[model samples]
Target: MSLFTDRQLTALKRNGFVVLSDVVDDDTIEAARDAFWDGFPTDRDDYEGLTTEPERFENAWEYIEDPDPFREINDQLFPYAEALAGEGTLERPDGRIQVTPRFPTGEQTEGDERPPLHRATGHIDGYGPHFDEHYEVGYYTVMAAVYLDRVDPRGGGFTVWPGSHWYAGDYYADHHLESLVNDATLPAYEDGEWTRGEALAHQTDPLEIHGDAGTVVFWHQNLLHCGGINTSPYTRLSAIQRFVRPDAEEIKRDAYANPWKYWEGMDGVELPSAPSER
Candidate 1:
């Protein structure tokens, strides 16, 4: 049986984030990690805002959806997801079981070095259009992150902006005070205002979450987080499964659609529009 518990769930609800200690095995993480790296497009232009600090990828979802490499992760996480989310959270017929394999601090080619944003969350230089990209407080309920490799501390382990959940949720729910989760409706980019200006400034450091190979981190959507940097020599890969309750509205990911390809499903889907009801 999986080791994630009710106590941890309670903590995640209260604080908006929690780390799952000793929840996965080395072999399982490695398998998923390898598959994702193999699929990253070597030739495409990773230009549009992919240079600096990183956490989650909106455009790169397909790599993790590859069946050859990601099937096992999909199989393993379903049961674990159900357990952590209580009995009926995931609706089997239409639910999405997801994961992300990230390669931070590595060469994408023969020579050029990766850019900054590799420092701890505190050190990241701010980017403009901050609020437009993120969501309001209760958009998603649970984010299950499975670390597929050993995450050394300076190697850019996952980081979250602590105590920001209260503020983030509130800003998102109201739609007037935008600070990174400034959102749009179902078709996302078809109708939205341009977010052009300086990003919000920060005074404190983001909550740093570094862990071993088998660690699993669960978070609320309102928690501000950045994907861990692979400051270590090896690649930092993680599979993330975002679990929303049965009746919830999702922040449409249309903006992240592949620049080269298009898919109908990515336009928008619903779990029942619990946008702010959480």
Candidate 2:
């Protein structure tokens, strides 16, 4: 039986994302949260300290070398991920766990200045110049973020600009068709012009997702998104996982041409067509 409902599939196709509530059990959620907190530095009094050297605490592996701590959550979500990206095409979950903890900003009064909910702007993954030597024109079938704790409104939630994936797919189709599949002509990370400007121009309002401990959010690869700033006292924790099709490289051109190309069971869903020109 398919793990996702027809409604869920349609939402993913139309909105570029969908939330699966309570997908992870309480025991698994507790264990994952325990693992995350245990890996956090005991010497640090608050999450703010970890942000100073963000990379040090950004991944669960940095503190807990063992993958056993996160195995349950990954195993539980693997089937759904496989269903979303097609059977036999989904890659096994890598042990790496991306840990994002948003620390609270002190008291706020009416008229106090604050950063925007989506931060300055939303960005697509794998195309930014800041990626350094590891950069390449990359694409993935699906991305998932599992919430380990309850996230309140403005509590450093995962924010997304709805429909930005179509905009990005159009941008790539218009400007980087040949370069997308040819490694030799691929723009270096430093020279790459990302879709942030286009996303900003096309999508003005961003949605911040807040949910319970076991909530799972699945998103498209080209969706424009960012982590919101935390204003609540509680620290927000979540794990990120990416799934890729085995034939990703082989289907690169077609996938770039149509953002929904690799998504199975979305055949009848009507979505806005990519613009002929940007």
Candidate 3:
């Protein structure tokens, strides 16, 4: 049975992303939020002084490793992701939580600034010219981002370049690095170099995702995205998970493999025309 509607599948195929609103219940969101708060080290006076600073942290997996209260949220959201990606697409259940607590800092006040324009922070999830020692090669198929708080413009929403994934897949394949699963080191390129430039050249409009709590965004692995700036009085919290295609192992072994080959039933689907084409 398909969990996604025809509209959703079309959105995913054409735009390279689909948003499922309120996929999780309010209870689930609150539970996860509470668990995170309880475990957070709020002892510092600085933590409460949001007016004076903003707090951001990644790799929230550590906090959940203990009693594991947040596991409930992941368990509930995983099925929706599976249905979207197709059956047998996941190799593991682990994901990460990202905490972005934005408040008016001493240098800036609430509504003082709008999020900077989307630039070419464009890169794929697992590998690219952005590859470095700190980042690992990725085997991610479909990437899911779930928002736990209301996300408004300038409130640190997720930003993405729509349809950039198609450009990236073909670009990497052209660069002769398509065979490797993880990080395939290429010549040193400037930041926001290839796809970002291509996206700009094509005048692709970057989307600043805004939604209510429990909004889930599913994006293609090759899509270029980044976390937007948080200029709101409220903090932004979200969880991200990457699922592997069923043929993850097989594709990982093939050097000439195109990542999109594993996307079930999408072989002949017509994607929306790119900006350059139109």
Candidate 4:
């Protein structure tokens, strides 16, 4: 009953994120960008020889061991993530729903230097240090993506700070997510020192997110966002994917410091004031 629309659930509870257009169909995002350029070794007109290959950016099963084209794009994004983590949340038979691979990258846009938004960073999807110093309160509540190409304006989209996920869930509900793991220990919201100095010290306004090829977005696992810099000329190709909210865990004890306490679709909404309490 909740595949969103109370104005997209109040713009995902005050702009944490939302954008479910054409949910998969531009010929399945050009056959998922031809299964991400069939693991390019370069030659789609060699867009800078496949974005300066580091193994053409690795991940789609390190170049297709084929899980049936990522389970047909996770059966079109697992029913909007089981209608927003509700209906038996991914049918958990103990093994709560988890379908991986959202790979395929290529940021391409350093020749024109756009770096604004205080030099961009806005994190929070499985936290930094290359992830896993344990921090996923209730596992993975939501992150989705799926674009597969056609993002315009400044191209490298999916940026965001709009209401910076309730000021990063009110700064992890008063810091202590494993003692804010590194950045010289919470140097300004977990390492990489304050993405643009905490969005200009919390005035907030970074947005970006243009879409087309089967769009999808979703966001909000304490959204803050980043990965936007291709200052236009094209080279986006998104994929991301992550859902988790069934038998979740790994929230390393802070006695559950309310990051929207398990987001029951963000109950009534309002919440947004923690850049040191605004």
CA lDDT scores, all candidates in order:
0.47, 0.68, 0.60, 0.57
Candidate 3 regions with alpha-carbon error over 4 angstroms: 43-55, 65-69, 94-113, 128-131, 134-136, 178-203, 246-249, 252-259, 265-278
Model 4 Cα shift for residue 86 (angstroms)? 13
The per-prediction CA RMSD against the true structure, in angstroms, equals 11.8, 5.5, 5.2, 16.3
What TM-score would candidate 4 get against the native? 0.31
**Model 2: residues >4 Å from true position, as ranges?**
42-58, 106-115, 128-131, 177-203, 271-278
For residue 169, model 4's alpha carbon misses the true position, in angstroms, by 6.3
lDDT of 4 by residue, 1-278 (tens): 55677777667766767888877667766766776567645545555554454421324445543345556677777777666655555532221222222222354345345556545556555554344543433346766877777776556677777656655555556665554443211234444234433333234557878777778788767666766656554456667667665455544233134555565555675534433334
Clashing pairs in 3: 126-138, 179-255
Candidate 1 C-alpha lDDT tens digits along 137-193: 233444667776666654546677554454444444434422332232111111233
Rank candidates, lDDT, best first: 2, 3, 4, 1
lDDT of 2: 0.68
Best by lDDT: 2
Model 3, residue 243: distance off in Å is 0.8
lDDT digits (tens) for residues 1-278 of candidate 3: 65677778777876778888867788877767666666655522343465444345545545544334346666776777667555666765654444434443333334535645453244456663333543434457777888877887766677777766665555566664443332231222234354322233125567878899888898887676777666665666787767766566456423123645667645455546643342
Q: What TM-score would candidate 2 get against the native?
A: 0.80
Worst 10 residues of 3 by lDDT: 180-189
Cα-lDDT of candidate 3 = 0.60
